[model samples]
Target: MYARDVRERVDAGRWPDVAAVPEASTARTAITRRVLRHALGRLPLLVRFPDGTRLGLGGPLVDVHDPVAFHRRIGRSGLIGFGESYLAGEWDAPDLVAALTVLASRAAELVPAPLQRLRGLWAPRHPEAQRGTPDGARENIGAHYDLSNELFALFLDETLTYSSAVFRSLPASWERMAPAQRHKIDRLLDLARVGAGTRVLEIGTGWGELALRAAARGAHVTSLTLSAEQRTLALERVAEAGLADRVSVELCDYREATGTYDAVLSVEMIEAVGAEFWPAYFEAVDARLAPGGRAALQAITMPHDRLRASRDTFTWIQKYVFPGGLIPSTQAIESVTASRTSLRLTRRDGYGAHYAETLRLWRERFTDRAAHVGALGFDATFRRLWTFYLAYSEAGFRSGYLDVQQYLFTKDAARTDGAPRETATSTTARDTTTAAAEGETAP
Candidate 1:
């Protein structure tokens, strides 16, 4: 009989007594008894085993009730269980990530939630923020990127780029690929053409890696960021790199940044501006660039009307993680930049796989450093929430639900009709090259 049926019978006190056959081994009987005990605890909840065993939580199962709803909520053993259960609030584990890690690395299993079946037909849609003011931008950027710098540092590469990494190959090497990220960033810098003595401007400078790299290339760089922590950390990085004279990090919103630059680059930042404000973002970039300057941007893109039918992960992210953030499609970015000051899409690359790898690395780092993370003032629940964020994102990328892109933008003037630089290198050239070759989608 199905577990659900057994559960119902057990609930009505009609459960059968333990079989006492002489042929049954004592160990086997004991194992069955123990499983039944656990199942009894999940009485009302249906626990699904990967082997098609439906265990009822009534009767003997009640003796082994899940104190934390671990079995009742997440029947499957892995990241999905922890993430799905936490999102549904079925279980209350102090560290969501930790709880998930245990299940993720365990034996094969899947536990389905009863509520998902009940609410399968319901879906609520929200209006997209077509337009947003500077205030809105500040709120969105701060909400997601402003999470603890220490947490970010623990997992990110030396550059600390929060966006997708460019991998050199499929299933990129973790042991031999430490230098892949450096090459990818260098390629982006070359695309911008910010060379020695070039006056460069960077918008949404999260963690200041790009700004520091530009300065290291001998460029006079001005960087803008909305997060106070980011600005502080960036300034510290600049000072340590002895680029204080050439690099200036400002705690200002992008809308307020004004100046002419030999080149401009904004990595994974424009998506937060919303579609309505995209024109302003392009204009801001145009205004800051010199007559022949180039601009490069990296962002995540989705299809038109994407996420309409799928679960609204955005709803959860908006409410709990990224308050006002939004992701736009490539069409949106193209439309916004088409009209103003003749822009050309010089090169394009997709680093979705790189991002997946990055997330995996983050998951490992976070799992390994759980103790330190707990010590950093984040409670167990917060840890689980953070883990869910990374794991689901990793799964999303692996499953092709998310993408990352790098675009090279050049002014009509910079197009001098001359061929652009094909490749570039940095002190961390090997790392960047490995990443670019593995994950980078060549244009």
Candidate 2:
């Protein structure tokens, strides 16, 4: 009989939900249980069961309440099912980020070597509907960014800067986040040589922060975004700042954008550009970049090997958090620029640890404002999903498996005379040293 039939029978009092009762079993479930047991035993984590049994060498603790359901879910959908199991209350972790950090650190070695090699045969691929075509890009971007700006404001700092911040120091305080965000924007502007009367093009107008800053610097800024929600709120914010005359926020895709500018700035938008369109995205940037102009991009990146291995495999992040997102590697960026455009990678600064801290602050704020989130009409499942997403991302940065970088690129014939030189060399050196110590590198 089907599992659902048995479940209905039990619920109707015809049968009891007990270990003594016969239950349907599948080959997939049996294999998943065995593989999971083997894998969990090797990791540096503590997996506790209701029966007082424990697995792994013990680091962060994972408490499993329904082993059968957990195994079944994983069997059916792999990592995606793992996330769903959490949403279903089959598992709990006292310290979610710590537990996930352990998993992320050992992610490459989770499955057996043979299975890892054969992943393409069994792993789920990204849905074609989520591909980043012009239309698909709008749909994909709207899926996340259109989720009310008020919801984001509950957690994000006042600046509404959704990307990573460059903190002045470690143990960042809540008071420092907004200033750090501005610091990061100013650095990108400096790298792009933005100045008075300069014409600037912002590829992704994230609530118009960069555009507002560029306008404040006396530059005429034209910013593009695909999200209708962002465009609406960004326009409001621009008007509030009284910079509407200098800045124009358009609900336009980079591919559809017209006109050349002295500087092109896209912060943390490259991840949303699918790998298939990376060349197109860069070509668009190159096409609009004025001669002797520079471009600055802030991107979240992964190791090249990891990027290649996971690019095609569907994950929980792709399914729920970011529909069409794919983190590129420094190698991928360098290769794409060299092969596709005249843009050359001039400088890169990695600050993954800062991103981890930023996420920590955001998660804490989210938790503290859970009631407000519920009041806004988001259900429990959504809250759990967002919690998992934020912690999962934070763990990735903590484990050195992911990094956020600000990259500076200049065209082949770019003139150097007007470009701004570093005024905070000491600070840059310190940040670079920390990044290097964390195993981050520039291409």
Question: Which stretches of model 1 miss by more than 4 angstroms?
Answer: 1-84, 87-132, 173-178, 307-314, 414-443
Q: Over the stretch 1-443, how does candidate 2's per-residue lDDT look in tens digits? A: 22233233232231121112223368878998899999999999999988898999988999988788778778766798788677666788999999999999988888888988888987889999999999999999999999999999999998899999888788787899998898888888988888899999999998889999999999999999998998999999999999999999998989999998999999999999999999889889888888768898889999999998889998888888899999999778877776777776667778899999899999999989999998998865678778999999999999999988887777666532233323222232223525422333233
Best by TM-score: 2
User: What's the lDDT of the predicted structure labeled candidate 2?
Assistant: 0.83
TM-score of 2: 0.89
Model 1: lDDT equals 0.60
Q: Model 1: per-residue lDDT, tens digit, 1-443?
A: 22233223231222111011023445544543454346333443344443444555322111112223333323221223333344333433343333333333221222233423432333233334412577666666676677789977777766777766565566765553345666666777877877799998988878888888888899998999889888888888889989999998888877788878888888888766755567778878877777667887888766554522233333444544566556776656665565554566656666666777777877877888888887887655566567767875675566455677777777667534233323322221121223345444323
Runs with alpha carbons beyond 4 Å of true place in candidate 2: 1-25, 414-443
lDDT to native, each model: 0.60, 0.83
Best candidate, lDDT-wise? 2
Enumerate clash totals for all models, in the order shown: 40, 0
TM-scores for all candidates? 0.67, 0.89
